[model samples]
Target: MAKSRFRSTTEHTMDSKGRLNFPSRFREVLNQYDSEILMVAPWGKNHLRAFPLPEWEILEDRLMTEGREKPDLANFIRYVVGGVAECSLDKQGRVQLPVQLRTKVSLAKNIMLVGMIRHVEIWDKEIWQQDNEATSENFDSFNEQLSQMGIF
Candidate 1:
């Protein structure tokens, strides 16, 4: 049986057509959602987040309802929710990433698909390397915070 959540990271290459061979392990997680559609959107400064259709709807609904009163949150919704691209995997397990979306994050030849629990993150290979290194640098502080929260 497939696992309930997405985890781990996998390297991938985008074809000239901008299609990526979606990882098989992540596809197993998608099966649990019973949906072929993925809502891909810009995340943070340098990555894209892909959510299953159902999950995307849930998030969209929340953004619509909760972002009404908060200016900062509304801005966030504008960036993340407004740029979503609906995508589906082809028979060969490749998904066609929109040119605009790909360009936004500078995704070119090499990329990384990162399992982010409920969603998956797509990052440029070089950017991910730099970001991962920066995160690793602060691991001790993060670990201490997690421990303080009773998570470690």
Candidate 2:
């Protein structure tokens, strides 16, 4: 299959009502998918992860493969699936994040949308700053380790 292309990083504001106006370029990416449904889940400390319906389904399918034998895998499937919600961009190219997700991520007004290969991560501005700093500090060591594995 062909790889998906993602939009670059964008900084956006979430309205007081928990509505986020997604970048127009990102909306265009979603338009290419069949359902126009975006799936979201918590990502680590204070961030949300967004994936297109197709990509989410692929992940779900892989997770389900271990359902027969692994109890832990079954629990993970349930947790991730239970957290999934369908999202659509409004006419104004905005998406209203469910309140639970918004609060889980500690998202307020300023937010960062970071492009991952198969998904986008929504992060609180402050958390993103700290995460970026740590990643920068470790970049050289991380790259060297990956290169040792012939991954770079």
Native-to-model Cα distance after best TM-score fit, residue 98 in candidate 2, in Å: 0.3
Largest TM-score belongs to which candidate? 1
CA lDDT for candidate 1: 0.90
Worst 10 residues of 2 by lDDT: 1-10
List where candidate 2 sits over 4 angstroms from the true fold.
1-4, 67-70, 148-151
Q: What are the Cα lDDT values of the candidates?
A: 0.90, 0.81
Error of 1 at 93 (Å): 1.1
Per-residue C-alpha lDDT of model 1 across residues 9-116, encoded as one tens digit per residue: 999999999999888888888888898888999987799999988889898888778767677897788888778899999998888999989999999899999999
lDDT of 2 by residue, 1-152 (tens): 55546757889999988888777777767777755678988765578888989988888877767566677776566656787778877778888899988887799889999888678899999989998999899888788889999998
Where is model 1 more than 4 Å wrong at Cα? 1-3
Q: How does each model score on TM-score?
A: 0.93, 0.87
- The alpha-carbon lDDT assigned to residue 95 of candidate 1 equals 89
Distance from true position, residue 150, model 2, in Å?
4.2
